[model samples]
Target chain A: MSADATQRAPQGRTLSAAPGSAGLARRAWPWLVAIVAALLLPWLFFDWSTHRHSGFALTMLSEIGLMAIFALSFNMQMGQAGLLSFGHAILFGLGGYCAAHTMNAVKAGAMWLPVELVPLVGGLGGLLFGVLFGYVATKQRATAFAMITMGLGELVAACALMFMGFFGGEGGISTDRVIGISLFGVSYSSSWQVYCLVVAWTAIAVLLMRLQTQTPLGRMANATRDNFERAQFVGYDPRMVRFCQFALSGFFAGIGGGLYAIVYEIVTFDTVAAAKSATALLAAYIGGAGGFFGPFLGTIVVVLLQSGVSLLSNAWLLYVGVLFIVMVMYAPGGLVGIIAQHAPIARAGRLRELIVPYVRILLPGAFSVFGFVLLVELASFTTIGAAQGKAFKIGPQAVDPATAFPWLLGAAALIGGGLWLRLEARGFRARWDALMADAKAKGVML
Target chain B: MEVFLVSLLNGLVYGMLLFMLASGLTLILSMMGVLNFAHASAYMLGAYFAFTISQYIGFWPALVLAPLLCGTIGAAIEMYGLRRVHRNGHIAELLFTFGLALIIEKVVQMTWGLIPVPYRIPAGLDFPLFTVYGTQFPAYRAFMLLISALMFGAIWLGLTRTRIGLVIQAALHHPEMVGALGHNVPRVFTTVFAAGTALAGLAGVIGGNYHVTEPAMAFTMGPIVFVVVVFGGLGSLTGCFIASLLMGLIQTFAVVLDYSVADLLKWFGFTVTSATPFHEVLTVPLPRIGALLPYVLLVLILVFRPRGLMGTRDT
Candidate 1:
């Protein structure tokens, strides 16, 4: 995650055009359209798509929204604030537990408030916990900070299981969201209805957090992150900046957690587990931690990979680990960095000229992808499927996995496709370089 | 009294096991500046490896070979994976280790299956050692104590008496200086990492049969090991030892005692029922909340003393 931001520092700094500049305006339109499309997605699915209103979409959407919030909140620390938290899920879980208890209280007639307003309680709960935890956590930065956060998270998670009053014990606690405020005169009985709430909260949180990046506090936090000694010499307390940022990030995470509680209507120990913390870390890292939207994009990609890929392979985590390692070592800026690398080309208005090259590259790429997928599927079918007492079939042919023929076929495809892709990539790069050189000589920027 | 004595003995045994894991972790962490989230996973691998090897050879042979296998794996990881990610800085290094941890878990699960492997004590060491205040202490526990003590002594000698150990001790304080002095720092790192992982593996080999050798064993033991490492401080071996034993004792003793917060409240003339707001907390006893005690101490230590007990520098 830090890799993305660190790499982008030189890029973002050197290219610090004004926010409202023409170049910026032109570049921002796609993002604006993307956000609009995202917001209008449920409506599009409800009205047009055949599989729009299925339970899967709603669940996926809820997951995306919650994780986006979590990732963005994580970015506040990792990207803007420069704190690498290994266990940011403490605030998320705290918010969840608080929301659970609040809902339970409401159910028991302890407090009367609309469900829409109840997330505020959760947010505040998170904010308070963040403040308390952050005060100590921010006393030291870097590795110490990471350790403290991890320790706190583990401690809280354990407490949640041990102390039944607050954490609801192992059985967890459930609440009803149906009794909450009627947004647009609609009680959230369905996942789609709940999605509306999620979208609204996600938007608000994202917007507010974006605004925070524009604030002096956020800028100072970045400065402090870049060079703490320099910041201290320049009359700013780095610790205070980190502390405030930690609390704010916790607030956003808490809001996300509240949304989680509302959607699931039940919160369990898994909600606050180390795996969840790792999820936010993965999402933020994969999307590219350089920009506000990087983590959001990462969350989408990760969730898609998580839900989509996990179904196909039990070794999905293995793939994720490999991806993370590769990204850290090679593409430090993640997907965003890859995109940002094309800035020079994009700015010269030569983006359209690369279409042929992209297509040329796509042939081997598609083959490589197919070969990889086949190998993964074959392996999964042999190992996991075998364990589950399932077998692979080809119409009337139920091939035995123990056969050498299948293994050889899979291996051949992988090797052949990989070699082909390597050759193709080299050819494409050579052609592109020649074209760019010719264009430069001809004085045709496009 | 018997319960208390038994709990103390159990806690001491657990603490010693924790030390074996945490001491190596402290060495690697302090010298190389890595938390090594996979340390417990290495321990788990040790257990699994022993279980596999013991199937053919004897338990005693498996004990020697399993840790060596684990140490080699650690060396491979440090050389291939970690060294490559090191250039990206500490966070990347951490993430790399974390990813390694996940992959290892999945791979172990794939190889071993989800069920707990019954890696029992050898018949020679299966009997009770003695009775402590009417509570029997198993021969295996005594064997564990002896082994840990031997490991501790060996580690002490390696650091104090041998040339390579002296190089490592210097590297612990000034890694770059050691490198400049012509002692291979990377070699030292590999050795320390291997040694640490070997310790963890050895602990797992012993604790596996003492506890259970399930795939989920890593996750269960991971946090406690971390707690011990943190509590012991980042660089200090003595601190690690004290912290490990303290944590072990606390957890064990807590599990033996059944008194809860409500018990204290009752003594203060307060009548409590299920309707109380804090009834859940009050009803849960120290023994039942044993799992939480380590984390609680970890947090307290982190908040109050971020450098940890006897740590020379902040982690």
Candidate 2:
């Protein structure tokens, strides 16, 4: 059974009740807020120096939007259907290849397709492959299912490398996204314009995926995930539900891939590699696969770390691996789940009581994170960095890792902060329990 | 004929190495239900550990010491890491191992640097054993075969003869029942996990010298080992052996075959050209397509026969 299934009670039969407009508005507001926030973000990071928009911010935001779509699509399998796929990137990359080909065709005057519809072309490509591969992949459940997906992933990845005509071998296929065509009198040249396209598509993809979860098919997928034998007894073919979910996920992944192709104007074998698939898995799982917008948040955080943190340290992947392992072991609900766990306390207005405890833990937590990063950086610099002539710098002070003092300081900070954090965490947990008991006494049941 | 014989012998050597890795994996998968993504990482660790140890104490001592160290590390991981994450279900366990695989690879890179180490065969075993027509077969490969055959015998004896082995055999099929019968199931789990890692380490000790002992060797060998285990049929040692040998032979022979689908089309009197749809795919030589055969075979087996060739369970 899925991890989330044990934590929550089985949802009641509310599928038959039609959602009222008020209920619809309650659901729609989050998307509205998201859309408004996305539109306003580029402006917030505008650069006034060169009189040009912030290319870095726009590109990063665009990447975040694309990755969000990818992770959300991945969640359809993992979070909803309980189908863990290691080959979802196949659809995304296939979609990208299709979009790239379409762009080339348009540039060659062989086709008159609008740039806006290219993502749709990518989705179609994803759907085609999803149906083809899903039939074989969905035949097994649990470990077998995971293994089959991995095999398919490897098969497609190998094919992508060998079949140079379409995949373009190692260098991959590149095309011009501009195409000299105007859609709504906006010539697509600037990174900002591409960011607009990504936002629009990401919103559509997210809304569509959310709507999908409300449908009977979506509920059936959850039913299948929870108990396949029970789902079978209820006259539903679990395989069919899995197949549909897998195909739909492919379509969304393809849309994400389409945006990727459009933004970069190139698609490579790396786009469809196992590493890219792992990224989707990491983002979705870390963000909290149990919630709708969990993957979106996870994607933004991961992309930020991938872009921002990678700039400062070489041990960024190591940090991500540690973070992912920590999440899996301790917080299976992910970052979103942790926030949602405190929803009742916030509603009961008892959230203020936890502030002191949270700060107590937070200070030590920050210190530990800093200390851990310092140790990793010092080790990395001494080994790999020094070879490349890179020096470790903190503000105005440049510390040489070869010196015994720096090593002692790093070790002291890490050990000291780690011990302090552990102590703080225990106290915080105790205080949290007290707050929970007080809230329960007040009849604010959680 | 010479090419065929040389390839066959080479394939057998490679197959035995694969079986050493897959046998351990098959046992772990049956018992734990985890794919053990870090299995190959353990193998890589074995290779690296051997390289480090052999540098100081020579190859003979390193062979025994490296695998023992790997087994201890495996036991520690199971006791601390896997035991902590076990309550989250198989997916979490799998993810934990996947993360561990990444961390291991990174750590390996950090410790050894990102390049192939000179972990070659010992000077005593460097010479060729015999000449097959014009081709030479190395004594080191014969040594690998001898080591693997001894391991196979040892594993077989330990499983059938010892009391712990019998308990492990029982737990492999019906773990809960064994646990209910008052056998220390968790201890058995740790032992089995450690043994599996040790076997992988042993494979690495020998295979690394035959191949290159590089940081990326884990990733390069990881998928192929999975293919062997899956193709052999989950939880069946005999099936794993057969699948390993078959895959090894197929991969070896495919590299020697230069023909393609276009050649078959030519025999059928079909005039194929560049204008033909899927022309590239048809005309590609089998040798060039060798890298894809295992994956293709894996998919076909999973789709057509989910139980694998000799698997009793539905994998």
Candidate 3:
């Protein structure tokens, strides 16, 4: 509890923050705002006439909550400890497996555990594996560390399929979530009840993670990341720092996995696959590894692109890959960095000045994106979509993939709009630089 | 004895193919200190390109042209993408390649759909080379081995006997000094990357038909190549070659020789049942765990010998 208070101290000490009572509210405001938003978000998607909620929206929100915790735990390694883990899903999948087994035990009347605390079981599972693997993986640093984790991940994923006893092989383990032993005697079965629990666990996990980041171990991890030799000189073992960070990150990841198992009621080898590990890396990196909230922000974008955009497009993976490449090349600091860049403009109260430039850029940007998507859809329709007997339709009309006209239009729009966006982008950069310089000169930004 | 000979021959062929990919990877790793994660993509692209090209000009032309095309693409990637990311750091460069891998897989899926393409052995090379315990070893396997052998000789000669190779060898260890000596190091980096990718492409051209040609081939091949690379120790081609062959033999023989830990224990007079602590592990046939051997080898090597069999530096 005291550790939590100490961590919250830094949250109230920013330059724009007020002192004393005002600072307390300022510190509390974002959490308050987030809590209210979390509560109100599902209502917006409610169908009043049906007297029911959008199951899809609720499920997606729950997914986002789980992935947010997972991705944030990943950030503790990638961003804080400077470890690029290619096999993080091992911890998560193990946690889910543990939780699923526990839930089954409870159902079979062999265990007396309440359903709400299953995530803790998952966390413990994750922590155990993290310790076991971290010892081997953290023996080396940088690229070697990455390779070891990759090897470990492959080993575990392969093991998951090979060993049917624990992992249940190809079929996977499933359990009934309604364990009938809730603290409040609530026999939780509905998606609403599960979603509420997800929200609460996400809050607790996020808070614990925030607190963990302020501890001496976290600081030492950072120190090692920046310069391990110097950290060694200062009497800290870089390897031990990395090991602890990896283990702790696993603990949090396991919590997320527990929630996943609870919500989905099953865990598969797919959970331990390289793709799942890549998800955490993608969410953390695309969100921004610099800030505490970056992974959460990234989780929303990634899950939206994954779960939401996937429903509409056959070429969603292509979009994700392209987005990742573009971000790595252009916005290495990620979406958080892009948003954070405007802090000076916001502080100077001149955010509106760039609105016109943004609008100007948006037009051609939309044009190019539309053109690209058209080409992608046309190609997709020619192949997989055609195989599935689906035609590419624009509103009431079906567009023939064999025709040259759509191709010509897509190519022309992509070329022309790309050139136009480039010109507009140049102008935007100039405007942004000028505004940023003015703000810096006026002492509105540092 | 006959089964062992056939497996050994098959393993040697497979190992040479792996070495072709690993050699290119080693070249780039030693030269630029950047692990090109998309090397497998290049291999996949080579197979696809060959499949498409063979439809137009026949297999012989495709065998020549596919690698060239792969080299050109590799050069372009190096010039436009990798050169820019080089300033950011090795991790960014690696991530950039990782992104390329994802994109290439999706593009291949989009272009060819998800099924395997018919990139088969040409009529000329489809004949059986010799009798191998009644299972005829196709002439295509021999051709793959021949090409890989030729590549090995050429690579060795180029590195040892040529002027550019010597410069590259120097740059492998001392890139800054090589640059200070007025060598255009970036051009050297580009050349090596192109050459390395071309080698992988060549391997793909031959190996694709020898195996299956599919969209997922890159991903399936990606990890094992990485295992070979790590097991060989980075920056050491010889280590890579030895490790590849060892992995090949291990994988090949693991399939043919099906025994379990339980069997081995039983041979030592220990009675075993499902009640054993690791019954799941012990009872499973070695063939069942064939997919896991290379990774297990890699992990054990990293834990026991980080430098691997014959590397100058630690992993």
Please name the candidate that would achieve the greatest DockQ relative to the true structure: 3
Two-chain complex of model 1, DockQ on C-alpha atoms against the true structure: 0.53
lDDT of 1 by residue, A1-446 (tens): 33334345556755776566776776667657866776677664563446457676678878999989999998999988779887799898789878978888887778887788667777887899989999978987887778778778877777877766667789888888887555467788888778878877887788899889989999999999889899999998899999999999999899988988999999888878888898898888878888779899888888888887786567677667666767777777888887876654544446677788788778766766666565666666665668787776544778776777766766777677778778778877886786566545544442
Query: How does residue A96 of candidate 3 score in lDDT?
Result: 95
Instruction: Report the alpha-carbon TM-score of model 2 versus the true structure.
Output: 0.95
Docking category of candidate 3: medium
lDDT of 3 by residue, B210-234 (tens): 8999999998888788878878876
Residue-level lDDT tens digits of model 2 in A1-446: 33233223222223423588866776678789989999899998887777788888899999999989999999999999999888889989998999899999999999898888889899888888889888889988787788788888988898898898999999999998888775676668888888888999999999899999989999999999999899999999999999999999999999989889999999999989988998898898889999988998889878989899878776777887888888899999999999987865664567878889989988888877777788777777776777887778866799877788777776777788889999988998998887777656655554
Off by over 4 Å in 2: A1-26
User: Ranking by TM-score, best first?
Assistant: 3, 2, 1
Task: Give the worst 10-residue stretch by lDDT in candidate 2 chain A.
Answer: A4-13
Q: In model 2, what lDDT does residue A81 have?
A: 97
Query: List-wise, what DockQ does each model earn?
Result: 0.53, 0.66, 0.76
lDDT of 1 by residue, B1-315 (tens): 877778787888899999998898899889999879889999999999999999898899999999999999999989987888888888888877877787788777766766787788888999988987777799999999999999999999999999998898899999999999898899889999999999999999998998999888888788788778788887789999999999988888877778888988999998779889878777877776777777677667777787788888766
Question: Cα lDDT of all candidates, in order?
Answer: 0.82, 0.88, 0.88
Clashes of each: 2, 0, 0
1 or 3, greater by TM-score: 3
As for DockQ, the candidate ahead, 1 or 2, is 2
Of the two candidates 1 and 2, the one with more favorable lDDT, higher being better, is: 2
